[model samples]
Structures are given as C-alpha cells and as structure tokens.
Target: MAWYDEAIFYHIYPLGLLGAPKENSYDGVTHRLKELDPWINHIKEIGCNALYIGPLFESVGHGYETTDYRKLDSRLGDNKDLKRFVKKCHDKGIRVILDGVFNHTGRDFFAFKDIKENREKSRYKDWYCNVNFGGNNEYNDGFSYDNWGGFNLLVKLNQRNPEVKDYICDTIRFWVSEFDIDGLRLDAADVLDFDFMKALRAVANEVKPEFWLMGEVIHGDYTRWVNEGTLHSVTNYVMHKALYSGHNDHNYFEIAHTQRWLDGMGGSSGQGFKLYNFVDNHDVERIFTKLSNKAHFTPVHILLYTLPGIPSIYYGSEFAIEGRKEKFSDASLRPALNIKDYKDSVKNNPATKLVAALGKVRSETPELSYGDYKELHLQNRQYAFSRNYDGRSVVVTVNNDDNDCMLTLPAGNSVEYVGALFGERITVNNGCIQVCVKANSGEIWVPAEKENKKKKLVELQTITEAGKISDASENKGASGTKEKSDTHSDINGIEADSHTEREEFEPSYEETSESNPAIEAKMNSMAESKKNSKIDSQLNSEAESRSDSKGNYEEGVIAGLQEAILAIMEKNGYVTDQMRNDVYNNTHHDSLVNWVKSFIR
Candidate 1:
C-alpha cells in the first residue's frame, strides 16, 4: 500500500487562503496566518494530513515564473512568516511541500537579466539560452529571451548552464534545510532536459532524502523522468483525460483509472504505483465544471479522498470553484477559508461531513490505504476494491450511477459494515447488505469483526451474536453459534455457512444500475410506452440534432450514459469556455454543470 492512501491533501493558494480584508496585490492581508489557525485547525479537524502551498516566491504573472528564487514574495509574507507556517504545520503533524519551478524563470530574474546585460562576458552568461534578444520569434527571428509562445515574462532556462544549475539547486536545498519541507512538486518539469534535472535532484536529496519529488510531466510516457534517480512520481494527467472523456464520466472513477496507467509506468511491468493523482489543479478549469453531469460531485469527492495513490485536492476543489483557461485565471475559484459549519442542506456544496468521514477512514485505518489492493468487483456502474495492510483490511465500493448498488463481498463469515458516505454504521437485510444508498453514493468498509482475524475470538463471537448473520453456515448445527466443526478446518475456524441451509438471498444491481440489459430493456420499453412530455421533449431534441445532416451546430451534450457520468465525473477545473459551450444546449443543464464544477475546482 502506498503511504498516501486515505490521505486527504488540502492544496492552499497562499494569496487567497483564509479570512483577510479586501486588499490589492503586493499588499499584506489585514489578518496574519497566526490568526487563521482556526481555519487551518478546521481543516485538520476535518482530516487533512498535508498542506500543498502554491508558489510563494517573487513573481510577475503570479507565483509561477519567479524573479527571485531565494526571497519570499512580500505579497504573501516574508521568509520568517513562511518558516513559522511550516513550523505550525509540522507541529500539527501535517507535511509541507514547496513548489519548485526549475524549468524557467521570469525575465526579471537576476541570473538571466545579468546574463543578458553582459552577453558572453557576463559571469552568469550561460544561465539562459544564448542568443541576442531583438525580435518576436525564436525560429524566424532568433531572439535570446523569446517569450514562451511569444509572451514576454516567462523565459526558458538554460539547464545546460552550470551557473543556472547551481542557483536552482541552491533554491531547493534552502527549502529542505530551512523549513524542513517534506516534498517538492516541480512545476513544468517536462520543460527541462534530463541531465540538468538529475544533477539538481542530487543536490536537493543531499539535504534530505525521501523528499517527495513529484513532477508535472503532463502527457505521454515519461518513464525516463519518473525513475528512482529522478522524480519520485508524476501526476496522473491521463486521469485528467477522464475529465474530458466524452462528458458522462465519474471524476473519481477516472482517478481510479490512473491506477492502471500508473501500473504501466517505470522499469516494472504492471508492478509499481504512479507518483500521485489529481483531478484539477491551479492551471485548469475547476473540476466542478469539467464533468458531464454536474449533479453527482459528492461521489467524486469520496472517490478522490479514498483512491490508492496520493490524491491532491487542488486548492479550491473542495468548494467546487469554477474557472476558464488555466492557473492564474483560476484565482476566481479560490475562496476565503470558512469557519462556519457547512450544513448538508446546501444543495451543490460539498458535504463537510463526507470529507471528515473519508478522512477519518484514511488516517485511522491503515488497511484501506496502506495495504495490498484486491479488486473484489468491477462493473460499469459499480466498483469494489480492497486494500489489505498489516493483516487489517478495508473494502471500498463506489457506485457511479444514479441508483443504489450491491457487491457480492469476499464471502467468509458475516462482516460488520463500518459506514458509507452517509457517515453512519451500516446494517444488512435479506441476502444483500441492503445498504440504503442514494444514486451517486458509495460505501467503504474493512473486514468486519466477524471476518477479521485480528480480533479475539470472543469479540468475533459477540459480533456474530448481533444478528448480523442470515445464514445457517455460520452456525455449527447447534445454537447457530460460530465454532470449528470436527471435519473442517477453515481459516479463523470459520464454519461453512453455505452448507448450513440459511434462507437464500439475492442482490439486485440489476434493479439499481440501468446497465443490466434487462434494466436497459425496461428503460426502452418505458420510453416506447410512457407519455411523459418532459422526457419525450428531450428525446425529440436529441433525435432532431442527429438528423441534422448539415451539422451547422455542435451537439455537445453527452449522448449516452458514459458521457453523462463524464460530464460530472470531476466537479470542475481546466474547462475552457469552448468546451463548456460545446457540452450542452439548454440553460438548466449548463447551470447545473457550472454549479457542480464550482464546488470542487
């Protein structure tokens, strides 16, 4: 099991976190971070273990392209305040990770500026791409400090340059030595060459080993970059692909898909874990708006916090922020920290109770996150997987459809259900556990007392006595009590329940998820027979659009069930206005998509 399992990461955009008076950029917040412990405490109280702060260095556009890598950006606070913040986080047992931007630096950065001013004669002349700066283009006009895509501020660094390498390496060493940060998320890692990165990493790791160095490798097979000598891991952008997987996708399930992609990475063949996973980050539309169906974000949240890899909740994602284009523009998604209790009645808002529950399960129990993973079940509408760690285990089931789901668990003894997203203990009825789940809700469990060997037999006996069993197999042909039979030796001395003539029970995912062919047939029959005007109008509009041979307009609405889930899979982030405009035709669906996107981006 990966160490990050069950871990809830709270990404904080430093410029906009907490309760501060209205102020201009470069000005300080009226309140200090010390005053905001109540908010940070609230997050800790809710179950977050690490804090991912946005760039805090001097910059032009935002914090990304830094002008000075060493000094703290005054707009945020000073170096002293940063030290205090890291100390506070450590005191609370939370880890801190700084944003490392070695790929490029702002044009005003001292190293590159000095190089430009002195040409080849400059001591720092090798710090940047060596060329005269005269024109707008790189290939056509040969400008030295060419804008990335013709922009003026972000100048690409000369990683081959030794002076530049030393500066970048020193910056990394400072964070680990000074603040004792646990990790570094390198920004724009793909922009730098291999040799430069390996050398810089050696310097950083010298200060503190086991430093989590996750990189933004974006797309393609970046295996060479993610090896042990380089990055510890790379963020799953393939899962980000799920955000745009034809609209009707489950954002959380998409994260689960990243597991497979990560499985394919590195020198191992289907052997290792991916670096980490994220739905939306600072550079994209809030995940809230990226989904096919904006109405089912709660399930997505539950999935992200529980899935196997290190999952990051991009700064404002918990609240579902909405935005267009990438990072800097995403500032609108960042909201001030809230101390007021977030009641469940608020329509599209994330369930605070749900986050707390998922977090508790992740941190307190090692099995669910840090154990061996076994895929117990997988269907189009339901996902059941187990993580077994330290002889303890947790089984998680996620139902992405708009219906209740039942999974035939790993059978042995009757197990107790700890809880689902509802934040309550679960009880079973009939043949199935009979969990009362709404559509788009999921449940996670560990091997219940009756099933777990870690418990004393007496405790196991107590759980079985609680009427959790509906079978004769659990009984040893006596008081329906648990006992080892004369001829059979089951693991944990669990008696045969199947042979014991308990009343037979059957589960019905067929009745819940519409994916069962019978359910689909029933839906088709209902469509042909029913006379509801509302659904018929939608069908008619869909039919008419398909019939339009000219294709004058783009029919952006997801056409099938997958599209439906994809539309709302992720809550929102990185969605361009073009994609949004293309996804739906009606105002109501659009509003729902936008609102749901706002909650998690």
Candidate 2:
C-alpha cells in the first residue's frame, strides 16, 4: 500500500514553528529546533504519520524565497542538525516531506547574483526565464527579469532549459539520498511546467517508488496534474471552497454535488480523484475565521477527514489559532508559536481533542481511507454519506441546521451499527438504522458486525497461508456465505470470503544488557508507561472499593476524577503525555471539555 494513501499530514511552517528571524541571521542556532522534539509525540498522538514541513533551506524571508538548495538555512540549523531531526522523526514513524520551490528563486539566489555581476556574458544567462540587461529594474538590480505572479522578489526559473532542469532534479536526488526524505510538496504547482513535473516524478519514483509527489493545484481539472506520470495528488481547492460556502449558505447540495463529481458518484467529469483536503493552510485564513458558525467547525473537519483524499491539519489550527491573511501581510496567519505555551493551551482547548479523535479514527479505519463513496441522503442543511470497502462500511451523517435531525440509514441489523464519534450502540429497526444527530453536529457510524467479519476472514487467511486450511476448507467457508465470493475488494479492505490478510508487522528485538542504547531507552520508557498505567488502575479500583464501603477516600476520589477526565479526552482525541502532565500539574482536561459542552448545550 502507498504510505500516503492512508496517511494523515501535519503541515508545519518551520520558520513560524521555530520562530526564526524573518530575515537571514546567518547564525548557527541549531538548538532552537530542540524545542520541536517534544512535538514529535504530539504529532503521533494525533494519528498523523507524515510531516509536510514548510521550507527549511537557506532563504531570504519566510523560507519560500530560496537562496540556496544545497545548504541548510543558518537561521534554522546546519545540515547535521536537520539530519538528526529527521532521524528522530523517522524513529517515531513520521515521514518528512520538504517544500520544493522549484518554479522560482529569490533575486539574491547565486545564479541570479552571478548574472547581475557578469551581465550578458554570464554563462548562466539562460538559467532564468526572462533575464535581460536592458535597463535598471525596480529594485535597481541592473536588469529586468521574469518574476513569479508579479512578485519582483521571486524570479521565475526557465524550467525548459536542460541545465536548469538537471540542477533541480539533482537537488531533489540529493535530498532524497542524503536525508532519506519520503516526498515533496511542489510549490506553486499550478503554474509549474507540466514536462518538468513529469520528469521530476520520474526521478522521484526512480529513486524511491513509494515517493509521493503532491502539487498545490488551486484551479482547473485536478486530473490533468495528478495522472500517472505527473503528480500523485493535488490540493482539493474545489471542496475547500465548497465546504465553507455550502455550510454558510445552508446548502448541503452544493458540497454534495461537488463531492459526487470528485468521487465519480454521479458520472461527473473528475472521477475517483483523491486530492489533499484542508480548510486552512499556510496561504489562507484560518478555518475558524472562515466558518460562519463556530458550531460548524467540527462538522467541517469531520467531512475533511471522512471524505476522499488525505486530510492535513495546519500547525496550531487544531487549537483554533485564529488568524487571517490581510492585504499586505500574512503575519497574522503565520504567527510564531512557542511550543511550551501551545502545549499548555492545548490541554484546555476542546478542538484539539476532537481533531485528535478524528485523526485516530481516520487512520485506523480502512473504510475511511480507501472506500467507495455513496451519498445516502441529502437536504438543505443535512447530509449523509457512506464509505464502504468489502462488507465493512461506515456511514457519516452531518446536521448543520438549528434543530436536531433523524437520518434513516440502509437496512441492517441493530447489533451491527456502532457510533464512531460517541461510542454508543446504534438503534436499527426493520432493516434500517435511525440515527439522530444533534443540531450543528456530525456523527460517524461504523458497522461493528462487518468489522468482526473482516477480522474472521483475516484469521482464516492466516491459517490458509500457514497450510493449516485446505482447498476444501476454503470452499466450505465460501459456501457458508449467502452468495459466492466473486466480487473483488479494492485497495481498502478484504473480499467477502476471498480473504487476504495485510497486517503490518514490526521486527522483534530482544532487550538485554547488550542491546543498543536507543532500544534500551525505548524499552525503559515503555516499562515506565506500563507502571504508570498500573498505578492508575489500582487507584481507580481503590476509589470504587472505598465508595462501596464508606463514601470515598480523598486520594481515591481525586484519582477517579482524573481517570474520568482522561476518558473524556480520549473519546474526543488521544490524550498525550503532555496533557496528562498538565492534568496532574495544572488544570483538569474535564473542566475544559465540560466548559465547551456547556456552551454547545
């Protein structure tokens, strides 16, 4: 399976994340990135396996205007520090994707500088798109040159030139080989040369077949950019616009129709195209600001995670870090966040919990990642859709109206349906499940029976593979089904009775006095975690036992209360170690959740 097919992306604008100087300080401040090591666990806690770190190379400002590709930005760190950082992330099962600003470069780029000094005599005169020594330019650069989107600071590259193409391709190879990075997110991909992109894809795939190539396509047919040889995926701008507009307008059909077109549900132009789905990113206003009603924010995020395509969470967005891109500057949107302060605030932020839950659910559930799209119901302010792979299915329903709404699902046994969002058993009557969603809320319902069936099939496959089951046994299993196992399951799940197990397995390592220091350290951490969990459980037992005997002990009551808080946090999002520390050190997670719930109520 493709690493990114089911991956959750966490986009971090490094300059903002690191709080680096806006301009180049040329200081070897590699220690600043030590602050980010704590966030690696936070990323994994939220179920994201991929980190789409914004520009980290030597640059002028914002890390986008590139000055050097071979060297690391002194403001951020040296190459050694970056390699160590990436290794740490890889150890935690996180794949890193760097920002590829291939289309343009800052005017101070080495080649551009060379041209300025040598004029028409420069050997690299043909490197840029429209360089000319005609007259003094606006910035008094002694020449006029092609700039990207009328931005004089960002000079465009002549991608058609073989020398320029080779340089970009070689740089990509260097990063992949040197840093062992997984992929690249092409900057300004919409206007990038199609031929160059195809060549780049070839190079990336040749180096590493699993290397993912995603583009920042804002408009037009996304299929044109994400075909076999060009890009694996593009940003889903169409849905990003439709989601907010549809919710604000109270028109579910708008998004429903667009979704159908993208998923090929109703014979639309673009079919089966999975684009990067996001409500906000580095370039736009925060989703919290774009949303008309604050109540709709979670529902919109729900859709982003459940719908086709990979879901990306902009850094600091999960906590409702509000900002908007104003006319002259994006300073508001790209605010520098102190890691400590952000972690402290996250413990009290309810959105963080919700986003974490969605991330975990989206990652573990196969149907959500690679399932067939089917719209079961739609209305003015309400919508329902199902993602089915093999027999396993999950039905997602959203109610954006002011009043609660009842949605009737497809005919199924009552015992089959389980609420993914709330962890409640669904009520199915007469072959149909009646799901009542709260006003301005969304619920994801997964069929428990189907999941169990898939697991059984996997077990059978394992037995078969091990030579424990014969052809006759396999035939017997197939005959036990209602119909013949003729249909093929897609990349998502197992085929009915034609089961195939695709479980991820890690190599077993024995821990001893001779074990590697890193392995020993990890084992020690795991042991400590187990000890803490045991202590928590014992405390809970004491609380319940004391409650039955006398009323309750003070310590037991506090422990019980902490457990409750942790449960609530896990239900909403995976509670991290930092959250737990915050709970024991400062405020309670339950208090923040209760406060948010009280407002919604």
Candidate 3:
C-alpha cells in the first residue's frame, strides 16, 4: 500500500479545537494546536493518522493572514507548543500536515509591512498585488492589494516574483527541518502558478522525500497537478459534490459519475496515491447537514474513507457536527470536543458501525486501501467495486435502498471476512444471506476461498472491463439485475442501483422534484470542491424488478467468460479504448446457470 494509501487524516482548525471554554479559547485570533491537545488525543483514540491543521504560521484570526513566516501565532500558543502537539501526534504515529497558503499572506506579512512603511524603499515593493495606498488612500481601508477576488485581508503573494519565492520556500524548509512536519497542503493551488508549487514541492521533499503536498485546487482535472509532479494529490471533490448534491440537482447518475472519476485516478498510478478524499472539511457545512440526516451521513462517511486515495475526517465530524456556512469562530459550527456525545448516537447505529468497520477493514485489506479500484456491480445505488493487489481482493457494496438487498457473490462459499475495522466476524448463516442496510450503507467482502492466482490479474481485468461497459450505460438510464443464474444462492440475490437504493434512504417529503425541502439544506452556500473523481455504474438497478422471476434469472448470467479476454486486453491500459467501450454494448462473462440457491426472502 502507498504510505498515504491507507492513511486516514483528521483536520482540526486549531483555534476551533479547544476543550476549555471559549473565554479560554484564543486570546485573540491565533492557532492553539497545543491548547487542543486533549481533544486531539481523543481523535487518536478513535483512530486517525494524519492531522491537517489550518494555517499555523503567525497570522490574525483564521490564521490565513500570515505575519511571520517561521514564528507561531503568539495569541494561541508558541512554536514550542506546536512542537509539543506535533510530537504528541507523532508519538501516536500520526503524521503532521499543515495548510500551506502560499498564494497570499496577512497584511502584516513582513514583505507587505516593509512595503507599507517604506513605499519605495523596500526591496519587495513589487511582491504584493495592486497596492495603491496613496494620498486619496483609496486603500486606506488597508493595502488594497487583493487575494484572487478582492480578499483585502489576505494580500496575494506574488510567487512569480523570485524573491517572494525564496522567502516562502525558506519558510517551508524551516517548518520541515526544524519541526519534522510530515506534509504540506497548498491552499488555493489553482491561483498559484505551476513553477511556484513545483518549487514548494522541491523544498519540502528535500527535507523529507516522502513528504506529501496536497493542493487545494478545485475545478477541471486536478490529475494534471499530480501527474505533472507538482503535487502528490488533490481533494476528491467530485465525491464531495455527490455528498451534498443529494437527489436534487442530483440522482444516482451524477453520484456514480463521481465514482467513475475516482476509478480513473486509481488506474493512473500504482504508487504515490494522488487523492485526498473527505466528506466535510473546515470550510463547508458539516457532513451531517448535507446528508439526509445523521443516519445517512454514515454511508457518506464510508464513501469518503473507502474511495481511492487518502481519506480524511474533519475535526468534530466524528461527533456529527452540523451547520451551514458557519462563521469561522462560531462555537456552534466549531463546537467543543465532544466525541462522547456522538458515541451513543453511533452505538448499534448501522451507518456508524459500517463506517468504523470499513475504516478498520481498509487498514487490513491493503488491496482495498492501495490496490486498483474497479467497479464490479453498480446500479440502483447498490454500488459494488473491488480493489485488487496481486491476488488479494476486497469487494465493497453500498446499498442505498430501503428494502433488504440480496447481493450475489459470484457463486462462491470461500470468502473470509476482513472485519469492517470494528466487528471482525461477518457470520452469514449460509452462502445465501440477507442484508438490511439503511439507505446509503455499505459492506465489503473478501475472497475467503482462493481461486487460480494466475487468474488474479485476469479477474481484475475482467471486472474493470465490465465496469467500463456498465459505466457507459449508467447515466444513459439503464440498470442491471440478476436473471436466473443456475448458481444463484439465497445470499446472492439480485443487487441494485441508487434509484433502488433510494427506497431505503428515501426523503421524508414527497417527490417535489422541483423543490427539496425534505433534504434539510444546510450548505445553502457553495461547495469549494470540484469534479476531481467520480463513481462508476457497472451496477444493476434496485429501482425496478424484472417482469418475471425466470426473466431475471435468464438474463443474470455472465456470458462466455469474456471477462478474461477483457482482462488480458485491458492491461495495456487503453484509457481511450475504455471510453470507447462505453459507447458500445459490451457483454460480460456469463457464469453457471444453475449453481446456487436464491437468497431473497
């Protein structure tokens, strides 16, 4: 597995993580990473390996406005305090990654202040963007220099300006060399040019070669940033969009679209995972708000963790934080550390159980964590996919339907349970079993019985090819179902798609397709995420049933074992061919017709 492949990151807005009362929060607006150690420790107990802290460099409130490049924000704590926090986290095997906002700095940032006090005398006068602090004092409000779209408080740092580059580069070096930080997350990466980010990467890697650099670049394909070597990964925004879009401007089609994007990213690299996926972050409304409810957030959390790349949990999310466009300092949005409060809500709660279970499973099943992800069964929100490394395989299915879902496991009884991180033994009564998951819930299966190892790679290839074909028909409004499979077992009932899955996670309100008041709109603002990765649709629909039992079984069989052919041919990685395959009606390998007994009750 890639170092970050199985990594689960937890983000904490330092100033917002205090266990003590708000009166004892930040003296002013500064980072209190240490002051929040008690809370951070709690996150570790629950299992998080990385901490993505917002700007820690000296700055005003929000820490986005940096004053000193190397010093810590005095109001909250000091450099030593930060070191203590980092040391504690490292002691727990957690990596320390800071939010690197190189694109801009606080007005008091050395260069800007130097220019502010000594108009032309400062050598770095050109370093700030559009400063017209003259007689009319048009910028008397402050240095009018902006950050992208006129964010005066955060003056854009001119990375194109070489000297500006040296200072920022040195700052990163100081943090890594002196503190031994594990990674750097570049903020507003889209605004920064290629060279600037490349420079930052060079410096950070020099300090620690495996040091990760995740860009906050939204929109367009962020794969360019990773493939071009400017970053190790960017946020998985497509799935993020799916998490919030719900069934409004959304449907199973759009959600699966995001999964397709994720598969594409996974195929591109067998090393150095290139995506940091999450459901809710510091800036957006908490995941609970966007989901149908806290119950639904469970599936979304599973979606974030198991999907490709490194998964992250924003601080307070483990406790079910909820709100929309909350101000940075508001206690309601940034509540006190309260994992205990949520512990009950998640106890016996299937969704939370699934999330906790799968996160643990992801750690053990390296294939699921680090292997190639290919869709196997996707339809009606019962999205099923497999992650295979060498001969090891883990299959995952997310059932978004209200009715009990009976997923067929390819006529086999030799699958072992990897444990869903929490509960280990998934004792199915027989080869035929029934699963009852709330809408947006998932379960993963591992091959307990070994097949021909030589066919291992072949198996992966077949699944991938089948996935591509399925993906093509996804949004086209088609869904798949199990026909009379000779081997159909009780547990191996027909799987389903999102539309079908929605039966379980259905909204409280009726289909006012035009309006979605039923969805409890929390993030009424905007999502900073872009379409970086998406889901695929090789699945069948739970949305509808076949005309007859015989028709379902007749059509459910895989024809001719062509999966082997596709597997062999797919290795060449014909991305172009995969796209073209979607346009045509490709058939999958049909299996034995009368092998197993039906499971659906």
Candidate 4:
C-alpha cells in the first residue's frame, strides 16, 4: 500500500502557524521555518505520521498568490530552511506534502511582470489567460487578464500553453531534487485543466515512487479527479459537511448515505479510492466554532479517523481552539499558535486525548486502513459500522445524543471483540454483540485476536462505569419518543435477527491499579467516603454557605472564572449538567473562586 493509504495527516498552514508577515517584503531570509522543528516533534508525539504543510513558495500575501514558484517565501525562509524541515520530518518518520498553487499567480510574478512591461511584445504574454491589450482592469495595466475569483491581483494561468506546462513540470523536478518532498495538494483543482493534471501526475510518477497528488475539490463526483491516471485523492468535502451538520441535526443517515455513495463509486472493493477526510481546514471555520454543542467534539472526531478515508487534523484543532470567518477576512481561521503554550494542556484536553487515542487505534488496526466499508447499524443519533479484511474486523459506533445508547451490531462469526480505546472486552454471543456507548462518545471494537497487537492503546479501566450495558430496545429517540424497531441492518437495509437475549453486566474496576494509579486512588477515596453518611450532609452545608454569600461581580470577571472552572473540570472529567448550571447561574465571584480552588485541591 502507498504511504498515504495508511497515513494520519497533520496539516499546518506555515505562514500563519509561524506568524509570518501577511505580505512579502522581499527581505532577506528570516529562518522562521526552523521554528517548526518543535511542531514536527509534537506531530509525532500525537501519532500523526504525515505532515501536509504549505504554500511555502514565494507569495505576495497569504501564501496563495504565488510570486516565484521556484523560491521559498522570504517571510518564511530560504529554500534551505524548507529542505532541513523536510529532512527533520523524514527523520521523525513523517512524510511531507506541499501545496501546489498552480491555478494562479500573483501580479508580482516574474511572468506577469514581464507581461505588464512588454505588453504585446513580451514573450511571456501567453503565460497568462485572456490577456487583451485593448482593455484595462482595476489596476489600469492597459490590458485585461482573466483572474481567479475575479480578483485581478491573482492572475489566472494558461494551463493550455505548452511552455507553462513545461515550466511547472521543471519546477516540480527542482522541488523533488532539492527538497525531496513526497507529494503536493493541488489548489483550486476543480478548475484546473484535466490535461495539466495528467501531465503533473506523469511528472510525479517520474520524480518519486508512490508520490501522491491530492486536490482541493469541494463539489462534484470525486472520482472524476481521483482515478488511475490523474490524481490519487481529493478533499472529502461531501463527508466534511455531513460530519458536522449530521451531528448538529441529530441525523446519522446523512453521513451514512455519503459513505455508501462514495464507496459504491469506488467499485466493489470499496478500497479502490480513498478521499482525504477532515473536519476543518484552513479555508473553513474551525470545528470548535462550527459545532453547536461542544460535547459532540469527541464523536465528530471519532468518525473522522475511523471512517473509510485518509484522516487529517488541522493544527490547533486537537486542543479545541475556536475560530470563525468574518465577511472578508480569514485571519481568524488561520491564527498563529505556539506549541509551547499548549504543551501542558495537551494531555488534559479531552479532545486532544481522544485524538491521540484514535490515532493509536488507526495506526494499530490494519482493517481500518485496507478493509472494505460495511454499515451494520444506523439511527438518527447513533450509528455503527465495521471494517473487515481477510476475516478480521474492527467495529466503530458513535452516539450523539445526551443519554447513553446501547448498540446491538452483527459480529459475523467472531467470538469476541475488545474496545481499542478503553480495552473493554465484549463477547460475541449468538453472532452479535451489544455494546453501550456513552453519550457524545464513540468506541472502536476490534476482534479479540487482534487485541494483543495493540498493546500501546490507552487502556482505561474506569470507562466501564460510564459504558454499562443497558437495554436499548426501548430507547427513546432524540425527540424523547420510543422507536418501534431495534434490529441491526446492513447497508442494503436488510434486517438481522434482533431477538438476542439481553445480558446484564456490572461495571468493573478491577485493573485500574496497574493501568492508572491516579484513578485507582480516586476510586479508593470515593469508596472510603461512602462509609460516612454524614459526609453528604457536611458537603451540603458548605455548598449552602457558599451559595448564600452572593457578591456583585463584573461580567468579564465572571466569564474568566467560568473559563477557569471549566478548564479544571475538564482536566478531571468532572464536567456535568449540575456543574455547568452552578458555574453559569451563580453570580457570586467568591463562590466560583472556591470552586476553582476545590477542583485544584
């Protein structure tokens, strides 16, 4: 298999991540790209095996309007800096791919400048599209030229020109020989000429074995671009939209349908093509900002990694940072962030921990990378699917509702399955396994025989308390109404037997002492406290006193206090409905401060 087929990508917008200047001043090399050395280590620590960072070529602004395709942007550094960065990533066992902005160029590009200087006599007049000397543009260059998105500052390239194709092909060769990069992400590929892409693919194959070509295609059938000859994959925007909206709307069918449609298009193997899947990218609002309910962060990302595609996590998204787009500014979506500021909090952030767990699950499970897609169960708020290959399977189930959900899924002939995230083992009885998924959470259940191979997975002994199996046959829908049918079905809508006997299993906390000493100590303390019935009364008395002393606090102070309280609660997994109410509804500044202190203690 190709490296991309088994890759977990971490995307970085270097210009923004390094806090480079918005416009290139043509200054000397800055060595800003060297700052990414720590980020490269961070990426490996998070279990991401590939890095997709760029628009590193010289640009006028935002790293997209290319000025010199052959040179690194002065705001970032010289080409040598990039070479060392790529070498560092390779040393860390990470593959690198750069953004290939071939569809357009900035007004300051050498060829465009030549066009503006010589007018009709310039040899590079044909390099750009629709150059007419008779008409004028907003810049009053005494000529008109086709521009990308009607922005005259971005001159469109003439892909039909042979000279342009050769120049771009030669640039790719130079990049391969100098930087030794692995792949390229074609920008605005939907509008790129197919002939140019074919030529580019030919050059890619000639330059390096298994060199990948992915495109930024938002709409239409992705197969048009990700076939045998043109490109390997396109951004899975179809599923990207469905992933967030489906959770927000409590509709799993939307995502299920997209998965089935794309899989069918890839033919019977279902692994014939793999699109690049992501929750958010540099062009869109961060997933944290787009999600209406913050709790769905876990489930949404669970689907991103487990689904039948190459998964990617945009920079800063693992920490649940929020960013949204303004009318004409994308600055918010691409803010500068330093890993040092988030290092201590990375392990405490639930999303980051979950991402690390999912990365482990994806890396260790071979079925997830090469297996065929099959839907085993689907509902408005809950869904289950399995990836099977050569008699091995990994089942994934996600719940978006506010209450726990029990999913009974077909297990074929497998005797048992173990949870990859928490290492909870479930026996397959009567050709099925019923697993309880916590609210706003998900699980990856792998075949029992495969568990030994995944020794590095996070083994949470306390998750069973949160995932106790309950009777979901009469579970209510998101609207609080009971559903009539509870049978598992395949993607074809054929129902399986739902008459299996319900098994009652108590929550177990046996192995916590070895896996997690901190949790074991907390559990022991809770148990000892239960021996004293007077402890509850004493806590109630203290709470009443804190509530009684309400003080007038400014809104900003209250907001800051609330943020601190939540941060503490998040680290301890103590966030609950009552805690939210106490934090948000209480007006006493001293009470909030006490809560923070209590959490810290």
Best by lDDT: 4
Q: Could you give candidate 3's per-residue lDDT for residues 1-601 as a string of tens digits?
A: 3356568788876544442221222245434455465655555655677788866666654466677768776655678878887888888888889988788887677777788788767777789766555421223433345443222456777788888898888888889877789988887776788998888878866888678889875444666687645888887765676755543232544455566655554442245345777776755556666655344554566566666667887765655545443211223334444344444333433433344444555565666566666666555456666666766556666655554465654312444443243223343445533333335455556654433222221000000000001121111111122111010010111211111223334232223223233332322211111101111011122111221333553243332212222321232222123322421233312111111111000
Candidate 4's TM-score reads 0.76
Can you write out model 2's per-residue Cα lDDT over 388-482, one digit (the tens) per residue? 77566688998888788987878333356766666657656776788888788787888776553343110000000010112222212212321
TM-score of 3: 0.67
Best-first order by lDDT: 4, 2, 3, 1
* Pairs of residues clashing in candidate 2: 411-431
Poorly placed runs, candidate 2 (over 4 Å): 27-30, 264-271, 344-348, 411-415, 450-601
The parts of candidate 1 lying over 4 Å away from their true place are: 1-7, 18-36, 133-143, 146-150, 243-247, 250-258, 266-271, 292-295, 321-329, 335-350, 411-417, 420-437, 450-601
Query: Model 1, range 1-601, lDDT digits (tens) per residue?
Result: 3333344677776644532222225444222445445556756866788777867676653566677887676655567777888888878878778888777777678876676566556676556664554432212222345333222346667888777788778878887777788887787676667888798668756877566777876544658777757876777665554433312543333434445444545321123444466777655455666655554455566556555566676654554444333211233434443434332312224444445656666676665455555666655566666666555556676666776765566621334555534444444344235444446666666545543334221100000001111232222221333321110011001111211111012113223422234543565445333323433454445545544643532343324211332233222223333233433322234333333232121
Any idea what lDDT model 1 has? Answer: 0.52
Please provide TM-scores, in order, for all candidate models, with all chains considered together.
Answer: 0.65, 0.72, 0.67, 0.76
Candidate 4's residue-wise lDDT over 458-555, tens digit each? 53221111111112111222123332211000100110001000001111212111223355356545543442333334444444544445442355
lDDT of each: 0.52, 0.68, 0.53, 0.74
How displaced is residue 502 in candidate 1, in Å? 53
| All candidates in order of TM-score, best leading | 4, 2, 3, 1
lDDT of 4 at 350: 62
Cα-based lDDT at residue 33, candidate 1:
48
Q: Residue 424 of candidate 1: its Cα lDDT? A: 41
Candidate number of the best TM-score:
4
Q: Which stretches of candidate 3 lie over 4 Å from their true place?
A: 19-32, 132-138, 141-144, 246-250, 265-273, 326-331, 338-355, 409-440, 449-601
Which of 2 and 4 is ahead in TM-score? 4
What number of backbone clashes does candidate 4 have, counting pairs of residues 3 or more apart or in separate chains? 0
